[model samples]
Target: MDQTTARPETQHQSVTFAEGLTLDCGRHLGSLTIAYRTYGTLNPAKSNAILICHALTGDQYVAETNPETGKPGWWEQVVGPGRPVDTEKFFVICTNVLGGCMGTTGPRSQHDEHAGQPWGTDFPPVTINDMVRAQKRFIDHLEIGRLFAVVGGSMGGMQVLAWAALYPARVFAAVPVAAAAYHSAQNIAFHEIGRQAIAADPDFWAGRYWEHGVTPERGLAVARMTAHITYVSEAALTRKFGRKLQDTAQISALGDRFEVESYLQYQGSSFVRRFDANSYLTITRAMDLFDLSADYGGVLPSAFAGTKTRFLLVSFDSDWLFPTEQSRAIARALNHVAANVSFVEIKSDKGHDAFLLDEPDFHRTLRGFLAGCAEHAGLS
Candidate 1:
């Protein structure tokens, strides 16, 4: 983990939607353009397609150069040519979500008409359903009638659930890691605090500051700092930093006067430089509002009713953001509906980020589940 040089930027191509399409947020986002990238070739039957949904801060640059920061793909460990995803066998596709700033249509993207400036504060509010709907359009545009599997973690996991609930027939299997059907109260509160931090910054200017050659860097940095703390476990922080001071002068401080504080500060600062503030606000809000039970008459099991898609839900022991109980709840509901589902609560001290990091146990479970999916799909 050398912090010397910056990562390489990932280039992306633009995709536009047809005219007269309305978004779920009650706004007309006409002539929408999205930035995305793809890997591997689709088989002649188009049945080897796999969709890799990205997390809140991720984009379509899976296993490719990151356009925002010139570096290897964020999930390169699991999504390359002979990796767990095995691009040699599956046509893996990843895209920037509709409300993301990485390349998809978001507050940072320019509106089609009306002076052709950045949408900024005028950007419509987006929901998880909206993102899934947009993805459906993208898949259709590619002539992919069905996906062999939909896999993701965190916010990406939420999209997997949305896809299963909204378009179950189109998905053969799903892998949702470290995610919940709905945002917990604690998670909602954390997101609200981050939103407040961003809004309080004078530079935010109601999310319209981008066009003015300004950004709410301080506010975004603070928000990232707060969220980063929750992504890792207390055990990890203790083992890695454990009150070890960066220098003698800093040790005299009252709180977090350790190497971890400095490390988190760097992570926070670097994040603001690469991500947009308004996009953060939009995506977090979408996560907060996601509730599969609401659409199923308050019956979580009903959400998966009549769905033939197999499910594999994984949770980390240290993941308080979406605890094991949340994963179990989803499993229980899927069982009630007689849907094929498997649940695994991995032993880890890495918290919610264990799925993204190199955890041997998590990888083993993922590999097994994917193998089973391949078998079921007859993709020998």
Candidate 2:
């Protein structure tokens, strides 16, 4: 099944489940739509299905060209015919999560209850568990009884952990890369700064930018630029840009003189064109409120009680955002519960973005884990 070809099982699709999803904040939506894309073929037994959860800004176009950006999929490097998550052997499903702007029910989506206006500020706040719950509904809609594995990184990783914690029996294997059970104070602070940047723009108009026919592009770009700095390490920034002048040897007070500054500007400007500002606020708030221990009476191990899912938790050495300690803590909790788990910390200075980059050792680790899980699941 070529990725570019449109098929019932391989093309982009959306389903509005009339289950009337209720948010963690106690607000309820009349209905919910989940936009998703599938790749490869499902085995007759339906045991070869793997759900690939996306990070904060990622969409469902996991292994194909994105219609919005016309660029290759975000995880195209690691999820193809012979890649780590090889599509040839695994039925891959990726979805635009709840509170997502890419065709999923989010701040930008229209609500019938609101007279067909966009949800905007009225969209209820969501949590990681909420996103996982929505994914579960979508999975059930597809009639997949159990997933072979659930894999993700960053916020995607957060959803993976939530899935394994909330519905342990339905998941055979789980891989959560570069993520923690809870967002740290530093992480929340960074997100707050980004949110503040978005809200401070005059064009925001109290989250009514959509109604005003204007967007907070400036504020959104600033937020994206600020957030981008935390995605890479100091070592990586220095190595790649290093005070190198954007042009000839002349420094200006205008402050776009350095290559790094120009690069951040480009990243920020490009992001606003594809993302909505209100959606940014909604998703970051969800990430901030994600705490696995909260549901387990402050005992992280209790969350995994009686869990049968196998876990492979991977962290990067240079990922200060969610460092090795976070992964080790998760491993410790799983060990306390006597659950099957493995922990790996790959050496890399690529920062939190290492999981998405081409790291051979990381790829090998994923392939090895998936192969082991396949054997355990009796997949030929």
Candidate 3:
């Protein structure tokens, strides 16, 4: 599907909800506003609603303008008319997560009532469950009693699983791609390294420097560069650049002018221009603390004990960040609970990013799964 032809420039409304108070991770967050974009109209019965959860560094713009970068939406290719998501038939909605910087209430948002500046380090820590709780309020305000499906990848996928476990009756189906039920020790370690890198920067100033005309640009860039490398496979890096010099003619004794280094440098620099360091800390911390099974008596199957929500779990062959084993763990738990679930380990060399990239097999499976869901709901 051609996203340009399917998606029109549509207006989005800024919505807020008083979520009473969040008790997840021993933090209380009050009065949250979620920035969301919706496409298609809800039927009279409101059964066609589909919630899209965005990954880390992504916002409410799924198939439209990105407020931060003034660029096109991130997941345009797979989420439009005739696309796998089929926006024409489903009322697609995507929201900026609770700790997001893109228009949603987060650390970067102003706390003028308290200090006349951004919340920054003053913002209370948030978890994936907290993000899901905020999203539930948004759905309730929209008067959507149930969702056709909740779909996401990476951290977005974490939210999908959290939704399934937290609100089993409200979600009809879930597609958690390239995500794990718990944050692996390795993943948490990587996040800690990034956080430490940011904290070590003199300009960080415990996140208070954003309002003082100082940005931790270099720290954020290095963090992004480090994380970006984990998102792709070794094979991809080797194939794309190898040890090739950036400028073949200017090869000197000066170290590391390789194409890979140049590529990572560009990626890191571009990311720092739009993303906030504080927001990065908040979101990554949420991801690191995510452990759905821990709350369910350490029995992963018990988490989905009585849920009827269908699940479609997917993993890429080279996705070391959230490998095939993680997806299989989810599937095995669902199986142990006798829940309706399907698993697919797609053969891709793109690693964790395969979920977001062009993978015909993944698209085909998604189309089939969505069609099945629609048929079950009698929407097709």
Best by TM-score: 2
The per-residue C-alpha lDDT of model 1 at residue 171 equals 99
- Candidate 2 at residue 283, lDDT? 93
Write the residue-wise lDDT of candidate 3 on 1-380 in tens digits. 10111112322356755554474767665557677888888988999999999998888889887754887888887798888999889999998899887767788765635755668898888889888988998898889999999999999999999999999999999999999999999999888888888998889987898657888888888899889889999999899998887665375676557888878888988998888899999999999999989989899999899999999999999999999999999999999989999999999998888888899999999999999999998998
Arranged by lDDT with the best first, the candidates are: 2, 3, 1
Single out the weakest 10-residue window by summed lDDT for candidate 3: 1-10
Where does candidate 3 stray beyond 4 Å? 1-12, 18-20, 112-115, 248-256
- Give me the runs in candidate 2 sitting further than 4 Å from their true place: 1-12, 248-250
Per candidate, the number of residue pairs that clash is 9, 0, 0
Please identify which of the two predictions, 2 or 3, would achieve the higher lDDT against the true structure.
2
lDDT string for model 1 (121-213, tens) is 677888899898888888888889889999999999999999999999899999998999999899999988889999999999888886678
Cα lDDT of candidate 1 equals 0.85
Error of 3 at 346 (Å): 0.6
TM-score of each candidate structure, all chains considered together: 0.94, 0.96, 0.94
| Cα-based lDDT for every prediction | 0.85, 0.90, 0.86
**Residue 156 CA error for candidate 3 (Å)?**
0.8
Error of 2 at 132 (Å): 0.5
lDDT of 1 at 11: 38
